[model samples]
Target: MNTTPFRAGHVAVIGRPNVGKSTLTNALVGAHVAIVSPRPQTTRHRLIGIASYSEGQIVMVDTPGLHRDFGSANATAMHKWMNKAARGALDGVDAALLVVRAGQWEEADEYAYQALQRESLPVMLVINQVDRIVDKDQLLPYVAEVTKDREFAAVALISALKRKGLKELTRDILKLLPEQEAIYPEDEITDKSQRFLAAEMVREQVMRQLGEELPYATTVEIESFEVDGTMLRIGAVIWVERNGQKAIVIGKGGERLRDIGTQARLQMERLFGTKVFLQTWVRVREGWSGDERALRAFGYHD
Candidate 1:
């Protein structure tokens, strides 16, 4: 007879910008460890979400999208930092999931695939956003083109928005993890703290609500987090690169910021299971995204 414990190990989710990496992480872990937005580069930091099962566990690492740096004059410091963070997470991981949109493969996907090929580990090609595909037969050619020059342990067709084909993907992932004991408590959903999640919650609203108002220069930081009884109090700062961006975020009469706060606070209440009091402040940081010290202070790790 063969006896073995549950399997568990880190699996890094990698792909180009706006390819549903964060959505897949949330579905795999059954919790929101990373923020999702329609705009590209929604995830700026590396996040860990843990999922435990009777047979094994999967620790999912959601990283920023892979963006190449050619050392051109227009390459910002933040872009380099984010790309480094994503590629660095790939090393020393048990497995990787390369997510891509359902339709045809683009050059961005090729860039991400090239990055995954360098890792000497099992990589699963995740074809996401199938719900958007009108004709199912069209997927065949697309799949062939995507896998033509690449090698993958497995490929899964999934619609992260509709939550389809996730079970099969999970089953395949369970088999790839190393056989070992659980790395975290069974009930734990993620390795991140409530503070980091709260900050991300605020950032999500900013990205989703203000994608047009502020496309590329906005980040959130939690100034204070206090819990007492069934109530939680949090103060956050929204840093913008320019004063005009700050005004746009705050809006006339502070209406826009209030909307962002209301949405973020409601999500936090659901996640924490407590009434939340959240205060938000917007300020102009003037090139913080390009400043190394500011990026570190905002929790950007190499």
Candidate 2:
């Protein structure tokens, strides 16, 4: 008979842009609840990913990257919203994971650490992408330098993409959580709805397929998500800031848009475990990223 008590609680996964927070969350949860791309600020919302084990459940609050440019003159409404969403994830959480890239700690990393320090929760330093370091011996010195002045509840060197050092990380995180019943059912993977996930799946492909500047100017909205028998019919609008951007997304003879839809539909089918009929359209919404009303209309609100 098992005598150990089940532990479960929320843990805020906080870090700078593209530090593998979403990747870590998806890995721990054993599902693609959060989208990932090579671009910075790919995650623009507060998403919850639930990881269930026999002994505990980790309700991970996967947040947007904590960036410093939100207060800058060039910062748009979208930037401010993303910043707010990241900060908001710290509230009422049992612990926080300050994930940073291996062998490098920049100003943005320090900024993220300071933000976590403001919160009273136990902040664990997750040194992610450790597999990228060619010299493994230098890891200890790098970790020492980062942890020199800061107080961390625990430190973990992990390669989120490679799934290395995860069991120990999970044990450390579970130890920080209180002993209690699971917050979510064992089978549940995320707190987001199917409709929201559908929109994100499309946006993930947009970020993957488009160029640097165009992705930041784009946002996806699901115009329709309906279930017909065993298949899901999803229609998404890829909103760009200009007509020229729309032309770029559509490409010559609409190949780009079709590819986006095809990839996104396959992802949806894999995630939702059903056939998906996906339709995508590129529409222009000029300066929508800077417009607060437009941001709300496209579901960027808290």
What are the clashing pairs of model 2? none
How far in Å is the alpha carbon of 187 misplaced in model 1? Answer: 1.2
Best by the lDDT measure: 2
Off by over 4 Å in 2: none
TM-scores, one per candidate? 0.95, 0.98
User: What is the lDDT for 187 in model 1?
Assistant: 90
Best by TM-score: 2
Listing every candidate in turn, what is its Cα RMSD in Å to the true structure after a full C-alpha superposition?
1.8, 0.9
Quote model 1's TM-score: 0.95
lDDT of 1 by residue, 187-290 (tens): 99887899999999999999999997787799999999999778999999999999889999998999999999999999999888899999999988899989
Per-candidate Cα lDDT values, in order, are 0.88, 0.93
- TM match of model 2 to true structure: 0.98
Instruction: Tell me the lDDT of model 2 at 197.
Output: 96
Error of 1 at 234 (Å): 0.4
